[model samples]
Target: MTWLVTGGAGYIGAHVVRALLDEGLEPVVIDDLSSGHRGFVPEGVPFVTASILDGGAVEAAIRDHSVTGVIHLAGFKYAGVSVQRPLHTYQQNVTGMATLLAAMADTGVEQIVFSSSAAVFGAVDVDLVTEDVAKNPTSPYGESKLIGEWLLRDQAVATGLRHTSLRYFNVVGSGSSEVYDTSPHNLFPLVFDALLEGRAPRINGTDYPTPDGTCVRDYIHVADLAAAHVAAARRLEAGQPLEPAYNLGSGDGVSVRQIMDAVARVTGIGFEPELSERRPGDPPRIVASGELAARDLDWAMRHSLDDMVRSAWDARRASTP
Candidate 1:
């Protein structure tokens, strides 16, 4: 059986493609190259350069590859940018998801492992968010992801399609290859860039109620996230009952100061960070309890915060021109 991986050339999607290959499954990729790089697609996998919003192109790719399942990872993901451009976020995340689902229905593809986000949980007061947490998105990006989950659930109920939505927290670390790096909007990559350039990193918002007076987030290794995606796809293929949603994250939360310290420890960079005012709609703390995913999908994180930072530092070093 072949799998269609949307955005397979992207940072996280490329790692998923590598995992799929490791499982001895063929993966066909579709990406528009807007934010994804063509060089990241592994050799011998059929890759189509097209947007998911184009129904005809998506349908053609599905039919050509005999795709039985889809790992949907293509969407807008910048939280702060989404607040500035709500319409674009909704169009790419919500409307584009509808277009892909319609294509899947047309082609009789019944399984999908969607890449959702923990931002869907919004500003929850709980220490650890679970699958049953009430979803109240705080930004256009988060709202778009919540709507994507609703679309998946509605399609499953109405069409007998089996799906799994992995609501991930902060995705960090580098893949085995140095070709893939962090997203430009992410905190770690920005810090990495500053350190590489002999510049000071900037820390935004230090008045939050967290232990370090900084925002706290659960950072999951990219490889671990990819493993969960493969597991979800395998379970769905086996006709297992669909889970409502799975939270993919480490159970522990790391603050911004902690991350900065890790970077300094790993890279020997002692540059002080520039303090800045908080960005709008920034959550004080967001941590995930992966017990549900651990029980249902047997997913567990193997990398530590030190490991994540070290691996990222190594990749950043290798990527330097």
Candidate 2:
């Protein structure tokens, strides 16, 4: 039984691919190389350079690989960019999910692990968001992901297609020495790049209600997130009934100032962040409660904030040509 990982050449997807391999499972990767890098796909894995929006290609890949399960990770992820390109975000995230589901139905692949985001919750009032919180997405990116999760739920009820949607917060840390760096829209990479370039990293807001005044987010290590994916896959393989959406996060909100402090502590880079006015749609606090994932998948985060920063800094330094 082979597993298909859409966007497997991207940052978190690549780490999930590595975890799949470590578990002795064959992972077939499908990435369009738009935001993903071909080099990130591990050697020996059957990789198909294609977009998930292409239903024909997706169906063919699933059929060709005899794919039994899927890890849907391909989608537009930039929250700010999604606001600017709402149509494009809808096309890539919403349409892409529809196309994949159609292809899965055609190929008789019933199980899926969706890469959802904490964006679905948008600006929640709760400090620790659980799975039952009302979904009030603020951006098109978040809406698209919520739509994907809805589609999965609908499909599961209508067609017996069991699926697990893992709602994640800020996914950080590099899983391998060859860093699969993300775009500048993400906070960690953007800060890392600025620090590396001898410039002060920009802190968008420092007057929020959080203790540090900056936005607070649950930043989970990519490796630990990948481990949760493996556990989800194993649960399905064991014929367990599909559970509700699971939150994969640290259950603690790390402030932007705290992150910068960790970076400086880890890498000895004493560059201070330049505080700026709050960007539009910037949430004050969006921490997650991973109680569901922990109870169901038996997942636990092992990396601390310092550990995450150090691993990311190491990867960033090593990637500099």
Candidate 3:
């Protein structure tokens, strides 16, 4: 059986593809190269360059590749930027998801592993977020992912589409040196870019009430995340019962200050991060309890903070000219 990995050429998507291959599953890729790189698509993996908004194209990829499932990861993912480009974000995530689901329905593709986000929870009054928390997404990107989950759930009710959404935040590190995090908005790349150019990396705020006086959040390794995705797919394929959604998170999260320290230690660059005023809506902490995920999806923090920084730095440096 083959799996159609939408956005398979992306950073996380490419790692998912590699995991599927390592697990002996045939993987096919469909990416429009919006934020993904064509070089990330491995040789011998059948590739189709197209948007998920194009139902005909999605359907063609599903049918032609004889895909038994889909790992949907293609969408507008920048939370901060989505506020300024709500229309584009909604179109890519909401409307595009609808288009993909339509194509799946048409082609009788039943199983899917949706790449949801922790952003769906937005600001929280509690410390340890769980699946039961009220979903009040603050950004357009988060709202779109929640809507995507709804699409999957609704379709499942209507047509027996086996699905699970993995909600996570701060997906860092590289599973392989070939696939690095390239997002300009991500913390890792921003710090990495600064270090590469012999500049200081700055923290937005450093006076929060955490142990390190900085915001703490889950920072799961990409390989670990990809492993959960594959496990979910296998369970779905085997008709094993699974939850509707699971948080692929670190039970205990790391702080931004801790992360900066790790970057300095890992990259061999020592500099104190300059602190700026806190960005509005930025919470002091946004950690999740992955106890449920650990029980069901074989989820664990296989990489330490230093490991994440080192691996990501290696990949990013290798990719640099």
Q: TM-score of the candidate numbered 1? A: 0.96
Give the per-residue lDDT of model 2 (tens digit) for 248-283: 867777899999898888888788789899988777
RMSD of each: 1.3, 1.2, 0.8
Per-model tally of clashing residue pairs: 0, 0, 0
- Per-model TM values vs. the true structure: 0.96, 0.97, 0.99
RMSD of 1: 1.3
Question: What overall lDDT goes with each candidate model?
Answer: 0.89, 0.89, 0.92
Candidate 3: which stretches are off by over 4 Å?
none
Q: Give the candidate order by descending lDDT.
A: 3, 1, 2
Better of 2 and 3 by lDDT: 3
Model 1, which residues run further than 4 Å from truth?
none
Residue 320, model 2: lDDT of 81
- Give the per-residue lDDT of model 1 (tens digit) for 124-211: 9988898898999889999999999999989989998889899987878877754456588888889988887888999899999989
Return the top candidate by TM-score. 3
What would the per-residue lDDT of candidate 3 be over residues 237-309, giving only the tens digit for each residue? Answer: 9999999999887878999999998888887788988889898989999999888889888989999999998
Candidate 2 stretches with Cα past 4 Å from truth are none
